[model samples]
Target: MTTQIKMTEPQMLQQLLKQGFEHLNQGQIREAADCCQRAIHIKPDLVPAHFLVGLVALEGQDRKTAFQAFNSVTTLQKNHPAAWAQIAKLCMSDGQINLADNALKQALKYPNKDPMVHDLLGTVLSKMGEHKNARKCFQEAVTLQPNHPPYMLNYANNLIYQGELEESESVLEDIIRIQPNSPQAHWSFSGAQKATNTKHIETMQSLVSEKNIHPRSLPFYFYAMGKEYEDLQEWDKAFESFSKGAKARRETVEFDEAHEVATFKHIEDTFTKEWFEQDQKGHSSDAPIFVLGQPRTGTTLVERIITSHSQVHSAGELQQFGLAIRRLSNHQDPRRFSPQLFTEALKLDPQKIGGLYLQTTEKLSGGKPRFVDKLPQNYLMIPLILKALPNAKIVHLTRNPMDACFASYKQLFADAYLHSYDQAEMARHHARYRHLMDVWRERFPGQFFDISYEATTSDLEPNARALIDFLELPWEDTCLHFHEQKTAVSTASSIQVREPAHTRSIGRWKHYEQQLSTMMSTLHEQGVPIDN
Candidate 1:
């Protein structure tokens, strides 16, 4: 006598869903999507299957498909917190702040929302410049899930942005204690320590060597070492460490004569006035105040002075301009610019571009009226910027080319910038940059202003006055006292920005005369004035 086994279709669907979820947890999105699709085929009403499918689509960067999938989940399960959170993240990426905010608000309406929902909301708020609100959300997230390192790290990041170094240190310490092997936590912790205590420099160096930290971490570690050496006025060691970091990540050398000729050819072939005009038409006529030049060229100092005025706000080097250009290109290769591409770019809605920029920046600087985008590399993008925002003012900060190149070559930038380390490459790139600027100046005379770093540092008052007038802002005494400004300095020149203006940095490249001999000759041949 054998008993017949009976299984319902619903039971099979449930089993598949379980298996799908397990695969999802193991990071097998494709496999999980297949299982979930099978489950949905068996039980078409299964909302979780739709949700899982949506997540898998997102992993594949198919936003439209993901949106449809998530929309299906919401149709089936109206109050799904996870779905709402996903919508918020999508909106944030698209630069849709109000929509992101509304979605997160809806997510919170559901009971027992995941701590991650709060964390995402916090990131959105931080980008919007609502630091206080962002801090509250991050704090709540950490409290709800204390063991989560990411949440703690984000909370610490907020603290660092607010210029609250001690508080950030405390948060980082807790994170390190919870997960001792976290390289990021240690690196960030080291950064905070470097800011507050010059004495901790030796300790950081020791840790870097002993831990055999990741290569990516080398730049920051060396940067910290350079800062310490600079603080001690140990110029040789500072130069060596800075050079090491720069050399490790150099993409190309700027000063090389051969590289210079190649770069000149590329610029002539690639960038043109018409190309800029098209880019300009894509953005609003309202030009942003661009502060650009070589790194350590007093651009940051100028920004600090200008931002100290009542009307101006300091926005750190904007990653957005590069992002905006990429978006406007619409996947068209920048190396292959054509009239059709220009026409397509020109037709982009200015209001949309401006609104997106304002939305993204509004969250970063706490809703300041006049913000600064102090990215040094914006020098290369000047044409695009001028075209996009015709009403925008351009401040071209100039330092002695030799000094600027030397400073660039010796610094360990966080991101890989090609020409910084190689002397010949650095010289060539610098020449190309100058040539482009000359063309831009000839094209748009009054719109661009050149402020020498020497003038700005040697005589702070006149330069400050000139800068204020250029920005069309009322002169404030505090602009002269930018060192006293209590804002968070995020760049490598952070410590330098905290002090009064000085000429000590000017012409400091002469000390490495032997090493920079080739660069010097290249600068002279390019007709760049070199005193040394």
Candidate 2:
């Protein structure tokens, strides 16, 4: 009777867990959390509840809370494969590849571990630059779950990375056949098509015209249309399509003042002279390459060109340096900047920060000789990077100020870059970026390379060769064929990257001159040269 009663309790716990999962699936996060917490309280050994809570916390962007929750799960089930895999994902997100690798190794010890474990391990291996091993893991995951969308997408992406365009296209086509209405599948197909330089405009046009298409499909449609027009050298049509796409992105003004205040405080707090001194103390190999300039000033294009070099890889946009500065200045109240706080920020672990950056790049580049970290906003942090890694090379991409400002104002960024919405704010930000770059040039002359977008477009091959020489890379013909390079570019300029290099982007602001007089006046007041 006692044995039977104990078995009944196990079934009851399983039923409760199912109920919690149902709540989770219904978008009731708080309710799901409550149910999971209750289940865990009832059965301290319930690993799933703990995992659910951790996942919920992570979804809420509460990393500390999520970590604590996952830590509890691991403590209770030391050898649990799922718990280890969860921890590995968290570590990967935190840029702790080594820890994630170890966690994944532990997870593979379990018999018949989830396919996601293999997928995640593959991602971590990819991040660590272990491409061969990552490919094996992805292959294993696909074999284990042949129809999984994520596994298919990731494996296809890997093939794209390896320049296997036909194979990637086939895989994406399979995805489209299986899930014809999937916006992401179409987007990936477009990317593969762009890479192969095959005409895909008609396919995209058909998708756009489908009744009841996904809202998320709009951006890609307009982006694809823009690319199509650009390929045909229809500059006005391309600009219009891009404008429509940017506007279609939904905008909300909640917490506008708070956001502005926080950003202003962050800028004031992090860019102090004292903060600069603190970041200078420790550095090692000077292999840092910065791709910086105004957003839409062709920084991404520059990155794509440089990264095409055999020795160079892309690190995407790194927020860590800025995050490090902000962390160091955390002792200061946001209400105002203090000299004392500035002095304390000066005492931060520059060596530690530099070490963290090196650690991150080492993983991302997979032992490539050089890598490009092209975060346009990094223009503001160039002084700190130079101080920390004096051997680092900075490439500053310059566009006509009006063109840059107009481009920025007309595009929509994800929530993080809120300043671009208003033309005046966009102009001000561009001026500030220019001023800062000038200051950096004065302070560290030979450390920087200034490339004009006009020069690059007017004479693509020569400028590209010069850039290669500047980076000390053996010239590759492929660098000159950058537009034909098919990699996943997650930026507003994705459409532009698909086409060959051209000078049509120049003087684009003139068409909207009447719409941009305020921005022009602001630029004039700031002494920015706009006539060109």
lDDT of each: 0.71, 0.70
On lDDT, the candidate that comes out on top is: 1
Best-fitting candidate, measured by TM-score? 2
lDDT of 2 by residue, 302-400 (tens): 888987777778777655565455455555344222344434545666666676677655666636788888778777566567666666788989889
Question: In candidate 2, residue 309 scores what lDDT?
Answer: 75
RMSD of each: 5.7, 5.6
User: What's model 2's TM-score?
Assistant: 0.76
Model 1 vs. true fold: TM: 0.74
Cα error, candidate 2, residue 251 (Å): 1.7
Question: Per-residue lDDT tens digits of candidate 1, residues 319-387?
Answer: 666555446556444332233433454456554555456555565554555778887877766655665
